[model samples]
Target: MAVSVTLPALGESVTEGTVTRWLKAEGERVEADEPLLEVSTDKVDTEIPAPAAGVLASIKVAEDETVEVGAELAIIDDGSGAPAAESAPAQAEAPAEAPAAQPEPAAAPAQEAPAQEAPKQEAPAAPAGGAQGSGASTGSTGASGTDVLLPALGESVTEGTVTRWLKEVGEEVAEDEPLLEVSTDKVDTEIPAPTAGTLLEILVGEDETAEVGAKLAVIGQKGAAPAQAEAPAAPAPAQEAPKQEAPKQEAPKQEAPAPAPAPQAPTTPAPQAVTTPAPDPVPAAPAPAPAAAPVTPAPAAGEADAAYVTPLVRKLAQENGVNLATVKGTGVGGRIRKQDVIAAAEAAKQQQAAPAAAAAPAASGTKAPAIEASPLRGQTVKMPRMRKVIGDNMMKALHGQAQLTSVVEVDITKIMRMRNKAKDAFAQREGVKLSPMPFFVKAAVQALKAHPVVNARINEDEGTITYFDTENIGIAVDAEKGLMTPVIKGAGDLNIAGIARKTAELAGKVRTNKISPDDMSGATFTISNTGSRGALFDTVIVPPNQVGILGIGATVKRPVVVDHPELGETIAVRHMTYLALSYDHRLVDGADAARYLTTVKQILEAGEFETEIGL
Candidate 1:
C-alpha cells in the first residue's frame, strides 16, 4: 500500500504552502519524521517530515509548486513497491485473469474499467452481448460523474485564486473544455473540465482559492439536473482517473521502445513503464489534460524561468533599470538565464550612453533634442507584491515609533588589514569570503552586551522595557523581492569567523530567494551596511519592537587627523568609516544611543580580533 504525503495545516491562517525544494528525491528511502521537503508559507518556511518510513516512490508535486492543506504531495511506497510485478507470473499463468479482473470493477467502483475490458470479453452470442455491452458502456459514461479538481498549476503554487468561471453552474461542458480561470502568484491560467458532462456543483467560487485536488466543479451525465453534488469518493477517483488517462496518452512516448522490445521485454521494464505511467501522469498530464495549463512541448525549465525569476535577478534588473520582458533568454526553450539578465543590464547602460554620446555632438555641441515631459511620463504601475508588503511595514514602523539618529566615525584600518591578510585562508577554511561586516557584527554584539538598552524592546501594554541578553543581529539585505533582514542568531556567542560564515550563509539565501520567513525573524538588533554601496552613512530605520538600528557606512581610505599617544595629533592615511545609529527615542535616550554607538566604535578601533583571525 502506498501512503500519501499531504500538505498539513501549518496554522489557522496558513491555508497553503509552496514546495521550495525536495531534500529527498523520488525513490530515495525516507525515515519516519525525517525531512523530505522544504515547505514555504507566507508566514514561515519549514521542513515537512515523512509521515512513515518508506521509499519515496513518487513525487506528485515538484519544487516551487504550491499546495494547500490535505493536498497530496507524494506517494510513499511502504514496502509495497512491487506487488503487481511480483504477482505478474501468476497473472501470466492464467489467460482468463484479465477477464477475471474485469469484473473487479464491481469491487473497484470504476466502471470505466469494464469498457476497457469489453474488447477481451468477446465470448457469447455476438450480437446480443455487443448490444448489452454497448448499453452498459453508454449508461456508465452518462451516470459516472467526475469531480473536477484544481490541478497542480505550477511548481510552488499551492492554491490558485479563481479569477473567473468560464462556464457557470448547470452549464453543459465537453471533456477538456474550459471551466474556470485561476491565478496564482506566478501564473494565470484557465482550467478545463475532466470529461464531457453536465456542469454541476461549482464547489470553488470565482475569485476564491482552492488547493490542488480540491473540488472545482462536478461533471455528470448530459441533461442531468445540475446540483451541488459532491463526487463520490473524490480522492479515490482522483488517483485512478490519471491511470485511466495514462494509456490513452500519445504513442510518441513509447513509440521507439515498443517496436524494438515487442517480444524481448515481456519480463521487466515494459510492465514498469505501463505501471509507472499512473504516477507519471501527475507531472505530464495526458492529452487535453494539462496539469499547469495547456499541454505544450515547451520545457518546464522554461516554464519555471518564466514564472519564478530569482529575487537577485529581479533586483539586478531593477537596479540597472533593465526591462526583464525586453531581455531575450539564451537558456533552454528561451528560458531567461542570470547571464541574460546581466547582458540586458549592460545593454541598457550602452543604449543610455549612446544617446548621451550622440547628444554631445562631437565637440560641435549640437544641442540635444528638447525632450518634452508627457503628462503620463511616469506611468502609474502597481507595486510588486514584496514591495507592497515592504512599503506597508515601513509605513507602519514609522507611524508606530519616534525615531532619531546619532552618528560617529571610526578608523577600521586594523580590521581592513586583517581581512586583507587572512581573507584567502578564511575563505578556504569557512568557504565564505572574509568581509568587514562580520567584524562590525562582533563589535555590535560586544557593545550590545555593555549597553543592553539599545538591544531592548518596549512593551507598552505591560509598561516594561525588555533588554535582550543574547544579540540576534538582523543584517538588512536589499533583496530582489524587497528588503529582507536575515538574522544571525546568537551573534554574541559566535566568534568572528563563525559570524562571517553565518553572514555568508544567510546573505546567500536572501540573494537566492530561498530565505524563509523564520530566517528573517528573531532579531534583537539590526545592522544596515550602507557602505557596501559607497554611502558615508544612512539613517536606517529601527525595526518595530527593536530599539535601535546601526548603519555601517563605506570603509574608504582617507587622510585623517590621528591623535597618536607617541606622535601627538599626526595626519595619517587610514581606512575610516562612519557609523549611524537610528533608535526609538521614546524608549532609548540620546545618551543610551550615544553610548552604544561609541562602544561599537571603540571595539572596532581597539582592534581585538588577532586571536580569532589567527594573526
Candidate 2:
C-alpha cells in the first residue's frame, strides 16, 4: 500500500505553497522525517518531510508547481508487495492526459512498455509495482485528477498575478518544467509543474490575480485524452500537428506583412516587395492552406490581442513621437498594443520616413528641465503581516499606557573580567557560548523582583496594573521574516548558564522557523541587545502586552572616580555600558523606571552577585 504525502499547512495564513524543488527523486528509498521537497510560501521557504520510511512511489507534482494544503505531493510505498491487478485501470487512467500534454519529450519507450504490458495482465496486482517503479510517471497521471493550486509568495502577498504562461496545454512538461510566471509583492517567480505530464488545462489567464490556493492549471498523464471537450485546445500549439500544419501555410500570409515592413524600410523597397510576394505564393500554392486561411484569421486576431504588451512599447511610442492611433494593431483583435506600435515605429525608422519633426519648443518654453522622480521615491510599501501585527500592538501599548524612558550607565569591569575568565569553561561545560545578554537578562530579572511595577502590564479600561510574580523575560531576535521575541520563562529562577542555554535554544529555533506561535506570546518584559552590534544606546519600543523593554548598549572601558567607605577615593578603570529602559508610563512612574534601571546597573556593577548567580 502506498501512503499519500499531502502538502502541510506551513502557517495559519499559508494555505498553499509552490514546490520549489524535489530533493529526492521518485522510487528512491527515504527515511521518515527526511526532507523530500522544498516549498515556498509568502512567509518563508520550508522543507516538507517524508511522513514514513518507504520507497518514494510517486511524486504528484513537479518542482515549481503550486499546491494547496492537503494536496497529495507524493506517495510512499512501505515495502509492501505490489497491490493486486484490480487497481491497474484506475492507476493507468489517472495521469494519462497530463503526461501527454507536457512540453518535455516523453520518457523513453522502453521504460513504459513494462508498465503498459503489466496493466494488460491484471489491473489490481500491477498497480503496486507500477506505482513504485517510476514515481514521476505515476505522479503525472495522478496530477490530472487533482488541481494544482497557486501559493502565496509571502506574508504580505494575499494573491499573485499570473504574469505569463510558459507552457501551453497538451505540452509534455518535465517534473520541474516552468509552467507559468507569477508576480507578488516580494518577488516574481516561475511556477513549475508538480509532476511530469501533459498540461491539460489552464484555469487562470495572464494578468489575472488569484487568491492563494486558487487552482492554476491541471496536468494529466501522457497520451491520456482530456476529460473535457475543450481539452484539445489546452495543449501547446505544436502538439496539434495536423491541425497546425494546415495553418502553417496560412500564418505566413498574416505574419508576413507585420514583419516585412520593419525589415524592408531600412533596405531597398524593391527587396521588400520581392520577399512579400514569396510568402504569398507559398500559401496560395497549397490547397489545404487556402481553406484554413479564412477560418484561421479570426483566432489569430484573438491571439494577437492576448499576447503580452509591455510598458516599454508605450514609452517608446511616446518618446519617438509616434501616434499609436494611426498604427494598426497586429496583435490578436486589432487592439492598439505595444508590439504593434513598436513594429510600426521601427518600420518607419528603417524607411527613413520620419514623421514631420515637431517644432522645437522655444528656449523659454523648456520650463526648467522637468525632473524625473525615482521609482522607489514616494512609494509606500504595505507593512508585512508580522510587522503590521507588531505595529498595531505597539501603538496600543503606547496609547493605552503611559510610556517612560530611563537611561543609566553601568560599570561592568568586574563582570567582564569574570566572564573573560570563565567563558571557555562555561561554554565547554554548558554547550552554550557565554554572552553579555545572559548577564543583562539576569540583572534585569533581579531588578524586576525588587521593583515589580516595572514588570507589570496596565489595563487602561480596567483601570488596573497587573504585576506578575514570576520573571518571564522576552528577548527580541531579528529574523529574516521580521522581529520575533522568544521568552525565557522563569528567568529569575535560572542562573547565567541556564539563561545562556535557554537563549541559545530559542535563538536556534527562531532561525529554523520552528518556534511555535505560543513561544512569541505572554512575556512580562522584553530585552533588546543593540549593544552587541556596538550601539551605545537606543530607546526600545514597549511591546503591547509587556510593561517595559531594556536596551543594552556596547560595553566599553572608561575611567571613573570611586569613593568607598573603607578606602580613599581613587580613579579606577571600569567596563561600562549605557542602558535605556522604555516602560509603560501608565504602569510605571518616571521615578520608578529610573530606580529600576539604577538597581539593574547596581546588580551588574557590584560584581558580588557574580558568585551568587553562579556566572
Candidate 3:
C-alpha cells in the first residue's frame, strides 16, 4: 500500500508552507518518524517526518514550491503497494523492452534496418504528444490570470524581499489592498493588488527575494478555481494514451517493409538519434513554463547587476553619495563588495578636490589613505530596511532643522541609592526588574510635564508650535536590525513601575523583531541611553518631527563639593553622570532646553519615588 503524506498543520494561522529542501529523495528508503523534508512558513521553519517505514515513492511538491495545509506532499510505498510498483516498471520496461524488441527484428538482418527506422519515425510523435499536453496545462492558468508584479519600492531599490504574504492561494483580494509586505534596504512597505480577483498562485514566497517588476503572484477572476494541478494531471494520461499506440502502429509499418537491409543501412543510425533526443525534450519542455512570465527575461541584465549589490554595499554607497550602478564591481561574479564602494567614494572625493590639492599628493609620491577592511567586510547580507531608514532620518534631522546639543552634569547619588534599596522589592511586586532607565524616563517625563517646550514639535508647513498634552516618549532601543524607537504612550500617566514594565515590554519586542509600526510612532520626545554602552555622553540627534532628545551618560563615583544641613560645603564621593540634550533650536531655545534638563536633574536628585516603589 502507498501511504499519502500530506502537509500537517504547522500553526493555526499558517495556511501553507514552502518546501525548502527534501532530506529523502524519491526511491530513498526511510524509517518511520524519520526526518523527511524541511518546510518553511512565515512563522517558522521545521522538518516534516516520515509517516511510516517505507520507500519514498514520489514527491508531488518540488523544492521552492508552496503547498497548502492538508495537501499531499509525497507518497511512501511499502512492499505491498501495486500502483507505485506497477508504474515504475512500466516506465522502466518501455526503454528496456525497446532493446529487447530490437533483437526479434535483428534475427533477420535483412529486415532490421527498416524495422529500426519505423520506430525512429514513430518515437517523435510520442514526445510531441507529451510536450503539447504539458504546454497546454502550464499555459491554462497564465492565460486568464493577471500577473501581480513587484512594483518599485523606492528610488535606487532594484529588489525587495517578500517579508510576508497577506493573501494565500485561492483567497480573494481587493484592488489597491495590501497583499504582501516587501522590505528593501531603504523601505519596508506593503505591495497592493492591481485588481480585485482571486489569488490563483504565488510565484514568490515569504523571505524570498525577487527583482523589481518581477511576477510575484497571479490573480484570476473571482470564483475561478485554480487548475494548476488538475490541468497537468488530466493531460498526462491523455498524452500517454497516444504514446502507447505509437509503438504498436510502428510495428505494423515495419512488417510491411520486409526488404533488403543494404539500402536501409544509412537509416539504422537514425533511430539512435531519434530515441536519444525523444526522452530529453519531454522533461525539458515543462522547464520553461515557470519562466514564461514576460517580466523575467527583460530584467535579466538588471537582476545580474542588482543581485550582487548586498545591503551592506548599498548602505555604504548611500552614505558616501556614490552611485552603485556606475561603479565597476571587482568581487566574485562582479559582486559589489565593501572595498569596491570605498574605492568609488575615494575616486569621487578626488574628483571634487582642487587641482592643486590633487597634484600635491602625486608630487609627494604618497598614495591615498586606504580604509582597513574589517573581518566582517567580506560577508554580505541583506540588512533590514529599518537601518537605512534610520540613517536617512538622522541625516534629515541634521539638515532640515537648526539642531544643537547642550550638556549638564547631574549628581544622581540619591536615585542610585534609592534604586539599590528598592530594586528587589520593586521587582517582586511589579514582576519587572528595577532599572535606572525607568527612573530616568520617569524623571524625563516629569520634567517634560513642567517644561512642555522640550516635548513640543514645530510644524513648518502649518507654521505653528504644537505642545502635546501627553508625553508619548520614544525609547531608543538598539535592536539587531537597527536602532528602533518604540514609544511608551501616555508616559506622563505611568508611574515608576508602569514605566519599567512598558520599557521592558517594548525592548523585548524590539529584540524579538515583533515591534510593529504602531509601537514606533506618536512620540513627542525621545530618550537615548548611550551610558548603557559605556559612553560618557553623546549628542544624540533629534528624530524627525520631534524637537528634543535626551542623552543619558554613564554614572561613576566622583568627588564633588556639596552643601549639607549639618556640615558646610564639603567634597565627597558621589555617583554622578552627564546628560546631553539635542534639540531643534527653532522651537526650543537654549534657555528652554536648560530648564528641562535642570528639572530632570532636580527630580533625579530628589529621589521622590520612595512611596511609588514602597521604599
Candidate 4:
C-alpha cells in the first residue's frame, strides 16, 4: 500500500515549514526511521524520517516548497499500499507508528543487555585475530569492520564538518572513546567510537563535511586478516580517480596560460609528475583500474578534462586537438558552448593552424602546486561549521522578514535590592549563583503571558496568528565557543528561584557542549542579558520563529524623581536599566511592544517575589 506522508507539527505555534532539501529521492530504498527530507521552519531545520521501511515511490512536494502541517509530502510504497484508499483500521491506527520517527528510550534500555553482551564477547576474539594480522594486512583487511558515522548533532542540524581526527589509521580505539571532533552550526562536539577496534581507514578527512549518518571511518577487528585477493580496498582508490582526473584536465589549461606569457621549466610541473613513483603501488594492485592506460595518458594527453563537455564535443575537440579556452564562447555568460567547440574543431581542420600543440606538450609536463592555495586568505582558515551555519541563518532572517526594535527605560531598583539581599543565601541554598538576568527572564516571561502578542507567531499568507499557551523562553547564553540559546521550557511556571536554577543548568549544558537538541527547541520567546558585560543597552536581533527578543542593559545607580505626599517630587537614587525589544513587525506593532515592556517594567518594579526568592 502506498502510504502518504505529511509534515508533523514541529513545535508550539509552528504551523508550516519549507522543504529545505530531500535526502532520499524517488525509487530509493528507505529504512524505518531513516531521514527522508529536511524541513526548515523559523526555529529549526530538521530531517523528516520515513515512517516505515519501503521504497520512496514518489515525492509529492518538491524541495523548497512551503506546506502547512498535515500537507502530504511524499508517498511510500510499503508493499501494503492500497489501490484507491487505506482501510478504516489503517486510518485509525496511523498514529501508532509515529513513535518510529523518533528514538524510543524505553525500548532502547530493554535491548541494551543483548547489545552490551555481543560487543563484550567479540572483544576478546577481535584482539586475538588483530594481533596476528596487524602488520601483514596493510589496510587490505575487509573481513570484519565497523563503520563510524557522524552522529546527529541537533534537531535542526543536518550535517557536520570534521574539524580534527584524534585517532589515526592503525590506532586502537576503545568503545565509547572520543574518535574525532565535529563542528556543526549549533555546537562543536567530539564524536566517540561505537566499539573497540583498530582504526582501519579515515574515509572523510579533516575540514570535509559528511551528512548525518554518513560513514566517516572504518574500524576493523584488531588482527583481522585480509580476504585472499578479494581487493575490497579497490573502491577507495577508484573514488580518488575521478577527483584526480579533474586536476589532470586543469593542469595543462592553467600551465598553458602561464607558459604562453613566459614558460618556466620550474613552472611546468607536469613532466616530473608522470615519472613520479606514486603510480607504482596502484599499478601493482589487483583491482581498481587498467592502471597502465591511465598512467600513460599523463604525458600524451591533449585538451584535458572530459568534464563540462558532451560526448560529441569531447570527440570533435580531441580529433582536431583544439584548446577549449581558445574557442570563443557564445552561450550563456560567454560559456564555451558545445557548438562553439565543434565549430573550432572544424576551423582547425581547414586552417591546419597546428594550434598550441607545443605549449600543450610542455604544459602537460607541469605539475599543480603540491598544496593548493587557500580558498580563503593565505592561512587556509575555515569557519567552524556551526559558526558558518549560524551566519547563514542570521543572513536569512535579516533579509526574509520585516523587523523593528523599540527601546524602553526601565527602573529595576526593587528587583536589584531583592537580588542584593538574597544573593549569598540563594546561592548557598540552590548551589548556583543568583543573577539579575533571572529576574529579567521571569519578568519577561510573565509579561509575554500577559501580552500574548509578544509570544505569538504570524503566517502572513495564511493570514493567521498563533499565540502560545506557555512561555517557553529562550535565554541566550554567551558560551566560550559561541552564543547558545537553550530554552527554559516553561519559564512562566517557574518562580524567580526556579528560573535562576533552570537558567544555570541550561547555561552549564551549553558551556559543556552537553545541551541536547530537545533542550534547544520549543522556545516561544527569547531574552538576552546584554547587561552582563556592562553594556548600557543593545538592540538584539530576534531569532527566527520567535516574535521578540528582550535585551536588558546593565543596571547603574542614577538620580530619579520620587513622589512624596507633601514634597510633590524629590530627587532620589535608584538602580536603573534600559530594555530593548526587537520584534517581527508583521504581527507585533510598536504599541504592542511598548505595552509588553510596560508590563515587564511594572512586574520588576512591583518586586512581589520576596516569597519566591525566600527573602
Top candidate (lDDT)? 3
Instruction: List, residue by residue over 1-615, the lDDT tens digit for candidate 2.
Output: 778899886764456777877866865556565567777654446667778766788899997688889999998886562332223432454445323322322221212222322223322221121122111111122223445667645433345556678877556788877888876433467888878777765655555445455556767775552343332232222122212112121111112223332332211111101123222422432231221113222222333434322334446678777766567754323444545676787887756533322344445454443355777798898655456546756776678666777899888888888888888877788888988788888889999999998888766679777889999888889887777788888999998888999999989877656675456556788999988778999988887767789999998888898886778798888788999999877667889988998899888887664563355
List the global CA lDDT of all models.
0.63, 0.61, 0.67, 0.63
Worst 10 residues of 4 by lDDT: 245-254
Give me the runs in candidate 1 sitting further than 4 Å from their true place.
Answer: 1-287, 291-296, 300-377
Please give the lDDT score at residue 208 for candidate 4: 43
Off by over 4 Å in 4: 1-381
Candidate RMSDs in Å, in order, are 17.7, 18.7, 20.2, 21.1
| 1-615: candidate 1 lDDT, tens digit per residue | 788999987753457877878877775555565567777665445667788766788999998677888999998887666333333333454434434433332222222223222322321111111121111111112122576766655434455555577876556888888787776544556788878877644544443444444445557875453122222322232223223222221111112222222322211111111223222423332221222122112221232434434344556777767777788865433445567777887787677778777766577756655465777676997665456546766787799999999999999998898889988988888788888888999999999999989889989899998989889998988876667888888999999889988998998877755566667778899999998988999988888768899999998899999899999999999999999999999988999889888898899998889889777
Best by TM-score: 1
Better of 1 and 2 by TM-score: 1
Which segments of candidate 3 are over 4 A away from where they belong?
1-374, 377-384
How does each model score on TM-score?
Answer: 0.52, 0.45, 0.44, 0.44
Higher TM-score: candidate 1 or 3? 1
Ranking by TM-score: 1, 2, 4, 3
Per-residue lDDT of model 4, residues 310-356, tens digit only = 33444566766887657775543243444677688778665653444
Q: Per-residue alpha-carbon lDDT of model 3 for 528-580, expressed as tens digits?
A: 99999889999899988899999999999989999988898999999999999
